[model samples]
Target: MQQSLSRGSSPLALLMRGVSRLNLYLAGFSAFVLLAATAAVFCEILSRLFFGKSLVWVVELSGYSLLYMTFLGAPYLLEKNRHVAIDIVTEHLPPRLQMPLAFLVALFGAAICLYAAWYGLAVTLDQFQYGSRETTVLAPRSYLLTWVFPLGMVLLSIQFVAQAVACLKR
Candidate 1:
């Protein structure tokens, strides 16, 4: 039988469950964003064909939507272990070493994600403080898009930490 972390009232287990739920919600939101982007593209194409003109904001909005979708979905993908992996070498290792190796790998991934989150947050805050805007006709605030990067990275880092904990438990 699978162990039930939810049955225990441990803070780490609770945190893991909370992060998992958040990731699921983010993934759903990302899917919605992707659909919106698809609709925008379709509308752009139809407008171009029928009216010989395209909406000025469609392309930019679509691009932003794609970016948001990627970032928002990343944590859920990581939590579900859906990210690409090359496990050929690791699979050959002895069974006893597998959990350690996985833990090490998760730790490394968490470190990278944390660094990315920190850097993204710094850039996002700078853009927000400076009132930076994209140099496009839409002229959207740069921070609006940049904030997603840090948010995703932070979530990814949390997922990695949860994975690392699971590896340790194993």
Candidate 2:
């Protein structure tokens, strides 16, 4: 029997290394956003409790932080397969079918993410076309930042495909 043993990627190692660096950068950015969100929440809580003044923008910033963190971390999370899953059925499945089933689930999840990303991109574009802005103070360009959703989802989709390929090879 000829066994095809998967080995190191000498040809694409450079590309993989670059991608790893990018993922690290994204993870760092997400961590920074999370820290900023925590600080904003803390300051908002303190201000509201002690001075009877609220940081209205804090709420919006917190929302942005949440979105950034979620989107930025998605690719890395998928690469690691760290998302929570109900493994009872998968675990009981025979060894031969496990990879296929997992790949199907991942493909389904990728499709859903892709659809959400498409809508997000469309909405963001519409906002850009209309020059949409928040009603509150600071009035940041809401639509420009909205493109992050589609960009992140695209990265996640690629990660899902790579993961599926890895599983099939195993």
Candidate 3:
């Protein structure tokens, strides 16, 4: 399990633990979302070819599913060290040099993701206040989708922070 710097008897630790669990659960849901989206796309193609008609909703729904899947899985992936990496320089670096570099990079990632989370929260709030709706045919409230951006960003930022903490603990 991913753990916060504060292990026990602290509210922050509790919150972090909850966030870790949330990442896991959401990641699982993300997998389901991907499967459903794929099935929807396949059905749409079949409908177009066989019935000579299109499933208009599939395109928009699939787009949303893609967005959700990307965001939802990110935190868990980062926490588990399964996220993408380009280690050309790092792999070649001496072991002593790599630790500080990795920690710094993790800190940088945390800072950037945190800033994005803050901006995403602002946009989400604006959408909520203005009652914005997507201009798409579905006309769903913009918040329905906008909320996920901040949620994902927040989760990712926390995961990055956790990674940095782990690096330091090493």
TM-scores of the candidates are 0.92, 0.83, 0.91
Model 1, 1-170: lDDT tens digits are: 01344347788667667877888898999999999888989998999999999798988898899889999999988877788889999999999998899999988998999999999999999999999999998999999999999999999888777778777767
Worst 10 residues of 3 by lDDT: 1-10
Backbone clash pairs in model 1 (N, Cα, C under 3 Å; residues 3+ apart or in different chains), count = 0
The prediction achieving the highest lDDT against the true structure is 3
Tell me the tens digit of each residue's lDDT in model 3 across 1-170: 35545489688788787887898999999999999999999999999999999999999999999889999998889878899999999989999999899889988998888898899899889999999999998999998897888888888888777777788888
User: What are the per-model numbers of colliding residue pairs?
Assistant: 0, 0, 0
Among all windows of ten consecutive residues in candidate 2, which has the lowest summed lDDT? 1-10
**Residue by residue across 4-45, what tens digits does model 2's lDDT show?**
212355645555555556766887899999999999999999
Q: lDDT of each structure?
A: 0.86, 0.76, 0.87
Stretches of model 2 off by over 4 angstroms after superposition: 1-13
Q: What is candidate 2's local distance difference test score? A: 0.76
Query: CA lDDT of 134 in candidate 3?
Result: 98
TM-score for candidate 3, please give it. 0.91
